[model samples]
Target chain A: MTSSDLQEQLNIKALNLLQGDADKIEKLIEIQMENLDTRYCPLYEEVLDTQVYGFSKEVDFAIRAGLVSEPVGKQLISNLERNLSVLYEAMNNKTQAAE
Target chain B: MTSSDLQEQLNIKALNLLQGDADKIEKLIEIQMENLDTRYCPLYEEVLDTQVYGFSKEVDFAIRAGLVSEPVGKQLISNLERNLSVLYEAMNNKTQAAE
Candidate 1:
């Protein structure tokens, strides 16, 4: 799946986990804010489109939409792997070069 | 970051996006089930500990727990990259071997 797709999947997984206990929902959003500042958080949150205080919608779409027929797009995950591999090799090469 | 940490982070991001719309929540869970069967989904669902219909707690904790002081633990996302890289190499190697 594309990173965007993986992202959506991850988002879906997160919301499926929250289940509106209010307390837990509150806690989860708090962490989300840590990564996404208030300005950014709302923009992402807008995906779900509830004036509700917690849970982001874009993330949920993956789950609601039945994304599981596919875990992540094969190519997207593959590209992520390739990018990482390059990063890993570069880091290793740099270290060896320095050594 | 560890896959688990990334898992948590993904979960957090997911919840932060949902913000409690019941219809969205329902759709989200349904998609979630596509990936996680009902029995598994609920078990994961219980992570949030809400009698509520949607959202999983384990996923939400990443968002709520102030986990951002760190993002997916660098090593985790990196490892995900590594594993994927190996798969990439192995697939290529097999194709080359076949040729």
Candidate 2:
């Protein structure tokens, strides 16, 4: 697959992993796949639009949804938390510079 | 203060609370207030430029840095994880709808 396609798939995979109840989590996210499906699943599109960055949301979403092993999920969340802490500092530091 | 000033102040307060070592943490983040100060504190403004969203980053950054009480930090992180999970699902569902 092309890079964009791969990105789309990974994004989808990460997202699927983040949803509720891993055991029951479906590999195929049954959203409205097209114009024909939209009538049934409108919430799908509305939510994807929210711009939440970083790793914890991705990992936590997966763990709580039951898509990943709990340990792995926790690891990802921890890593993100640490990195973002630095980034948070960096961002604030940057803002200070800007002013 | 006007709402904008309040936002700027809260944002500053949150950023200050998120930095390292609470007991030793200073309330005033001493960034270069102007051209005169810029030579010394460049990292200050650089950090605030990154666009990280949600509560966990806000709270965890604070706790790990020793700026906040651990209990309060954990509670914020928990709430963010839960809410973000729902948002992740919703976003994926939205993407599915888009297709």
- Against the native complex, each candidate's DockQ, computed on alpha carbons, is 0.03, 0.02
Stretches of candidate 1 exceeding 4 Å from the true structure: A1-58, A61-99, B1-65
For every candidate, the chain B TM-score is 0.32, 0.36
RMSD of each: 21.0, 21.8
What docking grade does candidate 2 earn?
incorrect
For model 2, the stretches where C-alpha displacement exceeds 4 angstroms are: A1-99, B1-58, B64-66
TM-score of each: 0.22, 0.23
When summed lDDT is taken over every stretch of 10 residues in candidate 2 chain B, the lowest stretch is: B21-30
Residue A1 lDDT (model 1)? 40
CAPRI grade, predicted model 1? incorrect
DockQ of 2: 0.02
User: For model 2, how does the per-residue alpha-carbon lDDT over B18-71 read when each residue is reduced to its tens digit?
Assistant: 333221212112222222222434343333222224334445433432334688
**Model 2 chain B, TM?**
0.36
Model 1 over residues A1-99: C-alpha lDDT tens digits?
A: 455665556555544443333334344444544543233343434322222322332223344433322344333334333533443354455557757
